[model samples]
Target: MRKITKGIAPVSFMEWVRQKPRNVDDNQWFQELYKQKRWDIVSDLSHHNAREQFYLCAYCCSEISGEGQETVNEHVEARALASHRSLDFTNIVASCKTKGQCDAHHKSQALPLTPLMDECETEFHFKISGRVEGKSARAIESIRVLNLGDNERNNKSLIEKRKQLSHNLMMANGLDPDEGLEDDELLLAVIDDLLTPTEGRLSPFAPVVANILRSWISG
Candidate 1:
């Protein structure tokens, strides 16, 4: 997964925080805010995260629009585990509303590593086969916790999705993994093209495709 660089929090959300009741705990206050369906604050938070993440899920790097229906405000530290951080903007991210994968699968479980960490990007490798392998123990656990499709057997859907996207990206750019591109400078340019966001959003799985190509250059 890509490492997320969180920027400023929405003013609307902060205002809601200030209005929180003294008697209510952080967890309760957050629940009330969500339970109330305060679309203004919720939409602001979702759009902010979505824009920062390039419209991708913080956990799986899948596509997600900023719309409230498609993107959810996922607490990196689950409320059950870190109640004090319930209202902390730094602890929140945008995640896809897909079932049984990201947010839904996370539940109240602990995530040893998260996108917020730079090491998270290095700890996992996205293969052209569309499987992700952990380079560290914590990374492995994080993969399990997020159901990041460690293998085709466990999460075929995600694997297949990544595989197709990665392949399509390669073919669209005229890169052949078996033959390998010959021009070093041209290859670097292609990688740069893949990384550069268009209209403020990276194409889905663009980094995964870029990573696979990088292995060729570095090898």
Candidate 2:
């Protein structure tokens, strides 16, 4: 998992949330909030969250196209369990569709290890085979609950995708004619680009890519 830096909530959305009636029951409160045509504000928040994640699903690290039911405003804490935080921007994340056994569907109310935490990235190790191993129980549970590596009928498992990506990265870097030459400055530059975040959006599974690159370099 990559670290996600949550930014300040949009002013208008914050103001809207603040104005909601505090005395109402949770269900009523949510009903009113939705009835108020606040979907645009929700969309805005989702977009911002997506940008922070480089348009990738927070759990699976898959690219979210933000098109026709491809994305959802995922509540990290789960609205069923934390209705009070239903409208909380900090509790929200943009995830991919939950039609399959994806994170949103599998995670429900279970609190998985989040990218928002500082130690999130260090919890898991990505292998060149595309498998992810957790360094702790929390990470392991999160991976299982999110179905991060589970194979689906029609779709490639997340690990399979990561493995392919790892192979591709190696192939790209290995193609250099002066690969092990002392003055192979281009090699370092290429590796740096793969490991660092770009000015625009990052490639999907960026953390996985970085892991593969780092292992290759160490070897």
Give the candidate number with the greatest TM-score: 1
Clash pairs for candidate 2? none
Global lDDT scores for all candidate models: 0.86, 0.66
lDDT per residue for candidate 2 within 56-83, as digits (tens), equals 7877777786543677767778777777
Q: Name the TM-score of candidate 1.
A: 0.93
Candidate 1, residue 36: lDDT: 97
For each candidate in turn, the TM-score is 0.93, 0.78
Error of 2 at 191 (Å): 5.8
Model 1: runs farther than 4 Å from truth? 182-184
Tens-place lDDT per residue, model 1, 1-219, is: 778887778999999999999999999988887799798888999999999988888987778998988899999999999999999999999999887788888989999989899887677888877899998999999889888899877789999999988888888999875577767788889989987889989888887777677667743
